[model samples]
Target: MFTLDDLVRLVRDELALPLPVNGAVPDFDHALNWRSVDLVRLVLAVEKHTGHRVPIAELYRRRNLRGVHDLYTATATAAGSADPGSGTRRTAAGSPAAAAGPLPGEGYEDLSLHGWFARSAARHPDALALRVAGQDLSYRALEQAVEHLAGRIAERPGGRPGRLGLLCSRTVSTYAGYLAGLRLGAAVVPLNPEFPPERNTATARAAAVDLLLCTAEDAELAERIGRETGIPHLVLPDTPGPGESADGESADAGRAPGSAPGPDDLAYIIFTSGSTGAPKGVPIKNRHVSAWLSHTVPYFEAGPGSRFSQTCDLSWDLSIWVLFVAWASGAALVVPEKAELLTPVAHINEDAITHWFSVPSSLSMARLLGELTPGALPTLRWSLFGGEPLTVDNARAWQEAAPGGVLSNVYGPTEVTCTCTTYPLPADPADWPDARLGSLPIGPVYPALEWVVIDERGRRSQEGELLVRGPQRFDGYLDPAHNTGRFARWSEDDWAPFEPGEELTDAHWYRTGDRVHTEPDGTLVYLGRVDNQVKIHGFRAEPGDIEAALRRHESVEEAVVVPCVTADGTTELAGFHLGPETDREQLLAFLEKQLPPYLVPRHLVRLPAFPMNFNGKVDRRKLSEEAFDLIARYG
Candidate 1:
């Protein structure tokens, strides 16, 4: 059996802590400041030495060095002279073998987005459906709220709206209003309350929104947007009170309930940042989202008793995944307060969140605040990171924090559905692949989807821009003018630029514009954006490659490399890292050893944190501008 002295030695050697020769170890909670990374290292060391995996959850309960020793001894004693597994044995919960085939209502003639939720409500009416900002609603209660809201929307000046705009945040009204729109056979368009009124107005006008729905807090803003766009506005109550029946509780309740949307009918429209400085609206049909749910609902193994985290805002496409994935699986969707999002570990543990999905940047923020302590998220069973490149270090930190959770890095563009590809990390860290650019490989494309990588020369290759087309891909941009140059055609064994005035069929591929490298086994490693490539001393360079090199340094926690245009019109690479103050000379020397002269950044800046945009992604445009200003001022 592993002794307490052995545990002390392992912790000291793994974490490089100063321990006294008298064999007295300090309490980790009070006497020692141990980071999550340190805890992971110590756990790994103990596992390696003892040959028996220590239960991280139990060790977390006793947050001291002695607790670690006791946990190790107990685990060793339980084995009783027989060698157990070296690592935690993971289940095949999310693998294809675990899938139970089609979900309920899959074969229904008219399958609207809300129809899935209604089916779950019918099957599990007593199940907890939504939890937002300390309020919980059962599936039946939420449906009643949707019905009441639908009746109210039906009595509006223009009657039932064909297209509805949701101007709200993470409030109950926002979620109920979304379902109400679907109940009225209206395509939902989520408008961010945090966004500027002008931007919201533009989006509303572009989508030709017939009505605007919001909570009381956003009533003023919704009214202003309605006035400017000539659309009617309705303020929904914060909670969808119970006892409202979909049959005919209100005078116009039964009259307002519209027919279910067909497979080809529009489900929702999401706007994404466009290169032309205008928001490009991507309209997903009911069938597209249905296809997305069909693949994801079973893959995640979500069902009753599963609690999903709602981290993405309504305006982002990822929120669709957060909402419907839970509803379709009869699981509860948990929305955290703004403050709770920063300290995700506490929220997960306190709420007993079993499924977590958010951008990788969220993990970085928690790591910065030292909230990712080992075994901190014991309730989490599936930890999903998306919307940004997930570094291996962040993956490891989160995995250690939720030792029993399955970690997956998902990837997709708004043009496609929420996600078309996923890479689930191995249960044992030793079997993880060495990613090409220090980010997790976006695993193989979904079996039902089609993908191709076209090189810069417009030929299929093992490395280049990624293009996707399948049931999940949208038909085209809302505006036909924005569709130009956004898609490609495969003809005669080569990809051709989609020309104007050509009929866009299912054969067309949506150009992802993301650069990726295909490994021998067919997995894809994401390289940065294709347009983000810059010329350094007349040699082409990818900022992601340089950023990966900078991240290799032990002192750097996060790294971002941007091309800064100097006053002389020359483009120079500027590197920024988030970590403790390190000698600039040492960073340069470290880069010199691995990178070529031109590949090395000209300037290295240390930042407390990266600026984040509304979607919780790093604001690279802001960083590039800041880098340019620094070069112009310093040079």
Candidate 2:
């Protein structure tokens, strides 16, 4: 199906290694000395393109580059011909050039996201809008269900613009619930069914939710939250039976009451980890999100035929981009169960996904599980990775697997709406940007958002703490106490070059606590965090909060949590405890009930007493140094 040259090119390009100047077969054993990531990428590309998998121990088993070419020729001769659509060459040049310069300002069709979806639904009434659990809902069917759910929400006593909680998994009820709340001019807060009930309870308490929406599966959880918070609940499918909630046919042909919510109106509230030992609510407005979609939709080239991979949960801010942007483009969003993420190649092929967005960890896990192959997903056109850095090997592997698709690494914080910057990689694997400080470059800034990196000296520089301000930036944290020192300001003189350094006035610039670098060409490169806060599996996490939760236990007196890299190269929480004469099993079990699954520490270290730094404070850094021994001795 593919030439050995194709195989050798992928290895040399991805591994950044020199191939034999003269045409010859590469030594499989020597080439196998390549980096773990690049080697994985080579195998992925070869297997997908040729349907040939080399042994993990032997690699391609070729003595030289010429040997690989002969093997490739022999393989092709053996197969007689390549499968249709197996080639990774350019497919008649891509769909036109992406417009450069600033994004068009007049493309937005409505003030609220729900309104835009309404227009799309009306325009393509029969187009597929959603697919969940093998059930497909057309645009017309989805619109009718939204209207019926809106009427039900209208009957509730929830006040105007109040918060409405939607507690459900990937189902028609959740989508209908979101539309219904927006129709009622209420801010919707999605409560993940997988999160600890206590965590959701605190989120609901923080948001001051007036109503809760749930499917039959989550009825008991809704009741618990409602009973705990005194908020009324409405069960979806209000009765027993399947398809009762999806509304396969129109409940009412006519539209529900008309409503016009402003651009600045609150749209949704997503909860993120709080350094203060509780989840913090981030309220994003319709305008904030609409501004983001204005740029990403065209950048991704999504439209009526685009099929988005719905991998993020509603609680995660990534959903904002995937959920609304697809609808605005009149595209169908394919929702897969959480478990499907483990074997994504199957779903990507079966669903013919055109666009993909997810954390690089998902890709790494898939590769670790051997779920990827060469020429596997030719349907993908755009593949974007965020939440964490995408390693050189991971990017190349994905690029080779989805040979026709473009790969990108995007970056942003929930505090600054969904996403703020996009770093699209060059289509040619050889042209991909080299890492800056060990991370792929996070390309150009969003057209509407302004970025400034401020150093510890409180002056703008090429690298420092990244700060973003513009239409996409949220108003502020939901809680006022969490807002201290989380903002910066710029004066008129600072905008224009007046002095070498001018004092700026107090104003509003959301401080993105991340430390980054700005290249001369205006590209941004993420260096590392200036603080202990981290993103584990795309969820904002604070070790202080994890430590606090551990200390809540009766046996624990002191705790410090540090980030630990597992053998598989995934980030995990490592909890070092001073008290609690306990084993890792007992502590993890206790923390499981209080923290989310991702927050649970994978490694537990118990100490007789906490270590102290020279300043008389618990030295977390010092504790991390001895983390391995502590775990080995006490784990």
Candidate 3:
């Protein structure tokens, strides 16, 4: 086992610097280098020295090289031996760096996602970042706009990274409003501008938002939500011209740029669908996003010449990832017209989009409709698939469409910044096992991120439950009781014991609740969710397989398979579908041809639209419960 001094020596060698004889490390208080890419290299070096994973959370917790070395040594020491008295945390020898107190990158301390745009403005003040509705904002112009609005917000009583709800559709004003909020050191709580007042009010109240910003189009909803939640609201014009600003104040007043948010500062609280329960907010920080951009932008080689498209909703966590990658990497973000965007393949070809980040379903639809013609998207360089499983068929189709382009499968919960794992499309996805699907190549935990797959028996393997540990990981749920039970830990200390939320086991892992299997080559294969998988007639069933098979039908648009219990308490397979021209018999035949009898749905319930929660995912529990009701009435 390497000693702390040995680890420090390795780090010095890796960074090509002289080692401190007394081992006095640099102070982390103010040592942020604007170059995020360099930090990733340091993380990799630390991992090499320790022969263990260094999670993103750990990286954010350890702000400087010195703290990284300390954590490495501590983790190494613990791995080298075992502490019988370590209790539930099981300190092998030394504890990993105690979660740095109130770091800027991860947990609840992160600034809203707009923090990246603000930081980018500082780097490239004059570059063009956004263009919409025949209007454009140069980076400098955008920066000035944000500053003027932030000045107005800062002037307001008790303004400092507090909750500021944003209600606007996908437009430049939406982006400007978000930036202005972040500029004033305030957290942005984005609401679906199209959502009804009732839904808007519930979200605002849940987040305890202090203020509301909206466009005239969403003025009514914003006003209603603000009134119900008792949060002050403001409306910005659709276009802020030469003398107008987001705030009612004049647009010409010069104001200093917003405060620089720390890496751990709370960036945004994005509400994501919870598989275990209700909709929960995932707080992301600046450094957490920085870490992701640091890794992904370089991995994809994105730059100013790159023309990227955002197909996901801005409210969706995936959309934020797409937006940040574009701005941070200096790529041009193209928000295609609503009509064109409805057709993913057409949008790519029409816009000459170089990079497209979309879910697997969209790609699958593009293939079935024959919209992925050769040379249609010749400029496409990288196509990323997220938000759902990428089956082998879909992966192969995507690869075929963009022959030379990189196809990446990204996976992560909204809680861990955006994505934690990414696997570029393989030359031969068909070679992968059918049970493994094309999905699991979830890849590695990003730089500074630590992940593991463990079974219920605590056995670790490529195939098991996925656990994540990184700076991008969420601090805790919004509710204190929820935080206490799920996010806190009880441990034995030398003195008195304390239930600190910062500590972790020798593993330093966060249970992702996702079941995955890794190939011998270390590529992750996504298995079905623990909750989604169920036994049917003593046969194991995976909904993803059935869904993938259902999607194979030419007439089927979108499909969700769920289990339902009859009034007699007998379990049955049910399918909630959103599609046109789908014949019940033909759908059943397709499933029967592709899936086993037990896995095939016995009941097919067609709907004009799937019941989607706030996060856009099919509300499976609600759908399944309603499935029984529909069967009882119609069947």
Candidate 4:
């Protein structure tokens, strides 16, 4: 057990916090102004020194040195005689085949996107289905709202729209509107209210949207987009009362239920950033998402009592996972307020979240706020990070906070379903692999999928661009023209580029553009984007490599490297880090030793935080432009 003096020294050295003099057992909350991160560090330090694990939650509740020591002693004493099997059981990788058994919609042939929720409602009518913005809806109540909204949409001027656009945020109407679209057998297109009207109008027009749905808060904006795009818009009520219909009439009056969609029919269309400055549409079918759910529902162990966090926006594909996976497993979909996202510890505890999914950038944000303390999120059982590379530091921090939870790094592009590969770290951190570039391995592709890595010379290799083709892969882009050079066919151990006017087949592999290397264990490690590689002073350099080197410094929390072009038409690398102020000369000296001189960044800038994109990933494009401007203006 640790003594009071050990706690005082650990607090001062590890956390940089002042404590009461003479070891009077000062109240950590009042005297030291200790945050969750500080308490977690002290507890971890004590455990390391004593070689015994204490109840971190109990120590946190104590909030003082004397209480923490006493609790630690009691825990140590009890643990001395405790059964080995009674400790936290190690989590194992869930079998995809096991997860396929007994879902809510089992044996339901030709199930559409909305069919999952309908089955869940029938199976668990009273179960909590949706919780958002201080409101809760049971599965039964939400299904009724979806039915009423579908009736309202079907009766619109368009008369059962074949395509529907949802213009809303994380509101009850947004979730209801999405379901309503699926209920009407219309392809749902999510439109962001935060985006420019012109962009939303273009998206609505491109998708050939027949109707637009929005909550009262976004009525004007929706109307503007509808007018510009020549589409009709309907405003959904803020909350659908238990008994009221869309227009306060009989809930079943003039109700025209749409026919169920076939497996091949488009379920939804998501627009991603394009190289030509216009968004590219990727339309996913019901079968594609069904394939994903078949693997994830059981892998995450979601069920009636589990509460999944909805961290992604409707426009992001991860939102699809949160919505359908929860409904499919009879779990509750919980959405936190925008502000609450930055402080995840409090949100997870207050909401009693069991399954959590978000971009790794969310972890970085919490780390910036000093909120990712050990055992802070004791209620979380499954935590998944995606949308960006998961750094070892971020993963360890999150794992420490949710010690009882299974932490996974999932990887995929929107072209695939939400994700296609996941790397679940061992329950014991000591057994985790020493991954390359300090990024967690992306693990193997799903057993249902087929993938290959092709080198620059067009030969199959262990390290190269990854290509995949499987049941979950999207057929092609909405615009066939965007399909050029996006796929390839392998014949006789060689690859051929997909040509225009040729039919796309399941045998064709979608070019993922991601560079990866297969480890000896058969797991794949992401090595940054092939297109993102930069040539610095006649030497090739990957920004991820440089960023990893920068993060090696004990003072650096996060790092981003971008190539900046000066006015002289010369390119140089600019390094940005989020951490305490350090002497630029000294930091560069350290990087010089770790990396080649040419790979070292020419300019280093310290930031309070990295700017995140709409999808919560680092905004590399914006940072590149900013770096160029800064370099051009200053040098």
lDDT agreement with native, every candidate: 0.79, 0.70, 0.63, 0.78
> What overall lDDT, based on C-alpha atoms, would model 2 receive against the true structure?
0.70
- What is the lDDT, from 0 to 100, of the residue 449 in candidate 4? 94
Superposed by TM-score, candidate 1 places the C-alpha of residue 154 at a distance from the truth, in angstroms, of 1.7
Worst 10 residues of 1 by lDDT: 92-101
| lDDT head-to-head 2 vs 4, winner | 4
How far in Å is the alpha carbon of 392 misplaced in model 4?
1.3
When sorted by lDDT, best at the front, the candidate numbers are 1, 4, 2, 3
Of 1 and 3, the candidate ahead on TM-score is: 1
Q: Give the least accurate 10-residue stretch of model 2, judged by summed lDDT.
A: 88-97
Worst 10 residues of 4 by lDDT: 91-100
Q: Write the per-residue lDDT of candidate 4 for residues 48-147, one digit (tens) a residue.
A: 6775544445555566677767766776676676652123112222211111223544443446788878878988999899999789999988888788
TM-score of 4: 0.82
* Candidate 4, residue 536: how far the Cα is off, in Å: 2.2
Which pairs clash in the backbone of model 4?
none
Question: Model 2 reaches what TM-score against the true structure?
Answer: 0.67
- Model 1 regions lying over 4 Å from their true place: 1-110, 242-255, 274-277, 628-635
Evaluate residue 435 in candidate 3 and report its C-alpha lDDT on the 0 to 100 scale: 35
Error of 4 at 31 (Å): 35
Residue-by-residue lDDT tens digits, candidate 1, 111-216 = 5788889888998999899988678999988887787778777876788888899998677878888998988889999999888889999999999999888778
